[model samples]
Target: MIQPLSMRGRHAVVLLVEDNEDHVFLTRASFEEAKLQIDMRHVDDGAKCLAFLRKQPPYEDAPSPDLVLLDIHMPRMDGYEVLDAIVKDDALRHLPVIVLTTSAEALDIERMYGMRCSSYIAKPLDFESFTKAVAQLAGYWLNLVVVPHRDG
Candidate 1:
């Protein structure tokens, strides 16, 4: 088992599982704008995110992320499937998962909450609101929340 590193009052590492390049750029920019000193990793698909989390083969040197921002719609595997897998895995279940997707459907929200997502955020269609939302999310998760550091 891999142990989580102790953070010296620094922002936690965040894994962003998103498929759209535009959204990725915007999200990254928002994080920077938020002034949160996070070590961010972006995976284009849920499958790659899962592989990275498992530290399998090529991901042998991968670090366990403190939080995950998952997109509901993606190729290969959707965020719901990824969330299900994470919650089921003993080693990864404790890590927080936040649903950051464009889907605002009640069913999606309920299902994600049922699967134990820490939070569910609907993506804003407007660019300004999107930026603000991202910034707020960063502020809340990286600054307000006290997360557990797991070491094995």
Candidate 2:
């Protein structure tokens, strides 16, 4: 079935790297009401995020994401490693990565910044607030920001 309008003009593809099912649900719900169209695709672990970015098997047809919503903790290849890989890759480095995690540890924030992630926001403890935050965060980056072209 065809989905209702979720975005207005240009299609914004987002790769959400989150292991938790609840978080993913909230994120998807928020995007459904966003002012612009967002093509949100999800991967449960950082490893799949890497594979998607690399266009590896089973993801060979995945389009390059306009933005990445990353969670720090996962089963394999945590967010830190994914951020590192993106920064190290010339073709993928231009895509923006936003760390959306629960931990407020200074070291994690500092480390992600050092690794050249685009932004970092701690996930709110409550679901309502978290959903709003996700929408605003995504809206800002996907709608307002004029990011560099991801196609290289």
Candidate 3:
């Protein structure tokens, strides 16, 4: 008989694609302060994000992310390109991606939705608002939503 998996020890893997150091720190701190029980892996560029997801070369042991928090503007590939590639890849397309960026451009929002982003959220400038938003997002995605298991 197969042993049951322990939920306490199994934390969701989150891939954060962000280039700005300040933003990264803020995002990390916000998540931590929110008491989220998940493993967050940071990628400074879209290329590295893709590489990690694909488990290419040096990232051979990288875990497949349960969710991806993407920033629209980044060096190398950018969020749009990364999203497109993810959608195109049969093995990775099922992974949920949320666009968490400072961009309020209508075109960007429309295009991201068209490409099947789980959701698009504009980053709040104020620390309080930012923390609240991050906490809510974490609660909703991690608790409310029924994510597909890795084997599924």
Candidate 4:
């Protein structure tokens, strides 16, 4: 078992860009089950994800996320398009975006890495595996990694 590192008295803020409500539920539940304290914000599609990141209109008061967990397929825009936009913008480029999707295709992995995604995770099919995966992800990113602090 991996021990958690101190977060300097603050919790990690994670932005989840996914279209499926079930996935959203699973993600939140997994964190809760793992006893990880992460402040998660959700956006259903890539367009909304961009809006939240850019702090536009309704999302103007949204907090800048410490990390992003993005899904590959969605309405309005896909993950690839979102990744492209993030990479091109100087303000958003510094943020670490992890591609979390069901697709484990080599081509998809190569494409995401080529686009400069911080990580690519092939989501597991079973509930137990999914929970474990989420726990590991949180443990690594929020506890083990020393990410630079930035405010939006």
Weakest 10 consecutive residues of candidate 1 by summed lDDT: 1-10
lDDT of 3 by residue, 1-152 (tens): 22112142578788999999998888988998888887899999888988998899678898888889999999898999999999999888988899999998999999999999999999999887998999988888887776664542
Q: Candidate 3 has what TM-score? A: 0.92
Per-residue CA lDDT of model 2 for 6-125, tens digit only, reads 333457788999999998987887767544467889999988999999999789999888889999999979998999999998888988899999989999999999999899999887
lDDT of 1 by residue, 84-143 (tens): 999999989988899999899999999999999999999998778988998888777766
Best by lDDT: 4
Question: Any runs in candidate 2 off by more than 4 Å, and if so which?
Answer: 1-9, 33-36
Q: Which residue pairs clash in candidate 2?
A: 7-36, 7-37
lDDT winner, 1 or 4 = 4
State in Å the error of residue 14, model 1.
0.5
List per-prediction Cα lDDT, in the order shown.
0.85, 0.83, 0.87, 0.90
User: Which candidate model has the greater lDDT, 2 or 3?
Assistant: 3
Query: Which candidate leads in TM-score?
Result: 4
Candidates 1 and 2 compared: the better one by TM-score is 1
**CA RMSD for every model?**
3.2, 5.0, 3.2, 3.3
lDDT comparing candidate 2 with the true structure = 0.83
Model 1 has an lDDT value of 0.85
Tell me the lDDT of model 4 at 66.
86
